[model samples]
Target chain A: MSGKLFRNFSFLSATLSFFLLVGIFAILFTYAQDAMHAFGIDFLFNETWEADEDDEGGVFGGFIPIVGTLLSTIIAMVIATPLAMGIAIFLTEIASPKISKGVSVAIELLAAIPSIIYGMWGLFYFAPIVQKTVGGDGVGLLTAGIVLAIMIIPFMASITRDSMNTTPLVLKESAYAMGATKFEVIKDVIMPYAKGGIIGSIILALGRALGETMAVAFLIGSVMSLPHRITDPTTSIPVLLANNFAEAQDLEMSAMYYLALVLFVVSFVIISAAKFYFFGKKAK
Target chain B: MNRLFVNKLILGLSTLSAVIGIGFLFWILITLSYKGITSIHWSTFTNDLVEGGIRNLLVGQFTMAILASFLAVPLGMMAGIYLREYGHGSKLASVIRNLSDVMMSAPSIVIGVFVFALLVDPFGGYNGWAGIVALAIMMIPIIISTTDNMLALVPKELREAGIALGGSKHKIILQIVIKAAKVGITTGILLSFARIIGETAPLLFTSANNQFFTMDLNGQFPSLTVSIYNLATYPDEASRELAWAASFILTMIVLCINLIGRFVIRNKK
Candidate 1:
């Protein structure tokens, strides 16, 4: 009887993730019906987000924040990928064991810091430096991207390192025996072996950058305009939601639900692709 | 000659990237400690947010996080046990693992929005229970992943030995397999606790923020992180300083817990 009870309870808890995922989707889709009826497909491309003069109902589209989310994630991926790859390479191939261990701890510590702390640091210490060097008012796509890059490098590096470390010793030794240099061994042997994991790590980091709230919220300037340049201010889905989700009502509230639905769907698809198509099979 | 030079260049760049990674970590830590130490006073910890101290915010944040742990830990561990022990590599277990992994990375703010739609909107306002639920949602996937992975690391021989001794399946898992993986699971629990305690996004509209100290779970709660978010954006010097002090303290608490988790695992090895 006790065994049966334990088994049944565990099975129920195991199903919780499926239920939670379905529940979130159902709730968001259910609530977003009004906005879906009003906007249909144009919501993705329509840039205007405003309320009517009476403050009851008006045009609310997802274009600016959607574009902002994509652009910021793009900038972050561009900056973070190469740096993260290099760090992974250093940890897996170049660094001595003691140095590697120390660096690993440092990277872990970096990853452990909260997103909000990154936001505060970026606002005070990093954004000013960006303003002085790169020329914007310091809070824009460029600053947000760079800070987001810093935030994800540790994650990306650690995963990439783990995958790269999985490369067989025999293959590397055979390459070295054939007179291959360190770089050649990495390029020819390790890269091909770890390609799935590396790409998956990059995509996963991209997904993270897309959804990151507080860090980007502080530096993305929270404006609703299209960024004319990389340094120009803009808003993202998360920043928009964080700054404005509370007091919104009526059609606007429905629109917020629509945006949330879009974010959840996009991230869901991205993470699914990374897990199933790229990294999942390889990991198994 | 060209190939050798290229190799040197690539290696040099990789090393430089490692340097850059470490450099940024130190830069953030140093700046945080400097600003945090400068702004902290006895009053900062003694007074509540109304008096510009973090006494209530700290208590409130911990209350929500601890309550969240109480909710997440058991459910997550049971789910993990189901996947690793009971499912026996079944297809259902694999699907749950995949979905749970995907859920682990679902955008946190979306979780907040979902919780708000359910707990806050229907109820008419933010409350401590809403915050706790949102955090538990964020933490469950992480705990599930860790427990599943740690339990997987236990040797098959242990389970066989338990079976040879005529132990029941559930008893074997509870005593033998779980005991074998105890250190790792404990570390995971500690790390997951560290992760949730620092989250600000999910708590943003759920518990929202309050100025005064209140222990009521049905009302708006004071959160150190949410308070930092609100205070840091203010134009006043005092508010910004308070934000700095809070951020510093939060970082220290998170990093120390993280180190302790790592230390426990290291000592085991």
Candidate 2:
């Protein structure tokens, strides 16, 4: 009887984290009620992000940060997807198995490298080089996007490779047996079958690019205004929260939670979609 | 043929693209080593951030990481065992499994906010312990999934062999399957550790940053990643150089962990 009870206890402990996630959403929602009540729809639409030091009323607007997050994520996805696809193709199709495994390990390590180091490299090394050519102070949206692209390439590439490789060997061989060239087989057979999964990887990459803080925080121009060009500096929602939360007082702190909430919800949708597609492939 | 030329061009670009991607990794490693290796002041491991030593922050960072691992490793493994051993195909298992995957990819900042709201809010300030909770939260899902996946890979034949000897479920799990999958579970734990070591965003809101030495868990504590951020953003050249050192240390630590983990996994196979 005691052993059975202990078994049940272990199961209960396992479920606690799922409950913890639910609790997080609840706590964030409750705390955000202040900003929710104050800003109402304006929280989602307003662009200005100012807060008076003593005002205590707190600033609450989502427009610029939301736009910045979306724009940078878009930039990252657009730039990373093709490069990732290229790497994935080369690895799966061109490289020897041993070389591919070595590169694969390298790519996996790339994904594991923490975000802060990437931020430091971008700020110190990549930004200066970009600044020289862009004709502006280089730490801006474009640089951030480029660094983000580099950071996410391994993730997208590996995912793309895995999904693409799932296309059956027999199918590819049959295409080859028809006198189809390598390009013909890839374009006609592999690409079509892997389309949904490749897309899923990109979406997952999008979620990553959106919530990333350290890497973009340095390179992206941290400002309140809209980025007029990719070269212009901007602040992502995560950046805003990171830069402000420590300094924020009372209601302002709650407003930052609202920003976290927004980021959380956006990532939730994209990540879920990506998981749905990527894992759902296995079920089939 | 025209098609052959186009194919060759595409293949060349793909290889070039892979080269560029791998090239960046080497470039960062080389640059970090070049600058950071020369700045090896033994004092770095002993000094406070403002005083130019990263000893306190490193301690604080590891304290949080170790505490988090202690918290996450068990619960995550339990969750994994539950999913694999008992709950497979159950509605609760499926929901939890999917949710765990989603949470595995959840934004670190969001998890920080969650713990900050849940723990820090009640305490009225940032402290080292709150950061531990946040970091632990991030580690849980990864460990859970890895535990589940690794334990599943333990052959059914092993379990049945133990069962034939009249072993209870718990005994079979603890004495047999867990032992078999020990290496994988350790790899998962180490990878999760590496993932959180250089984390800055979550620490930004939870532990915040401490410039001076303080070992107090419930109070503000110095942390390496946060210090790197603070140092890197400073306008002064000295601070930036220190930032590179910190980056080098962090990158090296993470790389070493990865190398060790990969080597171990390879050896296990």
Interface RMSD of 1: 0.7
Clashing pairs in 1: none
Q: DockQ of candidate 1?
A: 0.88
- Model 1 docking grade: high
- Best-performing candidate as measured by TM-score: 1
Per-residue lDDT of candidate 2, residues B1-269 (tens digit) = 99888788888888988899889999888888988987769888878887888888788888899998999988899888888887876878877888888788888888877877777878988889899988988889999989989998899999999999999988888889999999999998888899988788888879888988888988887888998899887899888888888889989999898888878898988
**Minimal lDDT window, size 10, model 2 chain B:** B86-95
Reference-based lDDT, residue B116, model 1: 96
What are the chain A TM-scores for all the models, listed individually? 0.98, 0.94
lDDT of 2 by residue, A128-189 (tens): 99889986688888899999999999999999999899999999999999988777888899
Judged by whole-model lDDT over C-alpha atoms, candidate 2 comes out at 0.86
Q: What TM-score, computed on C-alpha atoms, does each candidate reach?
A: 0.99, 0.97
Share of true Cα-Cα contacts across chains kept by each model: 0.84, 0.66
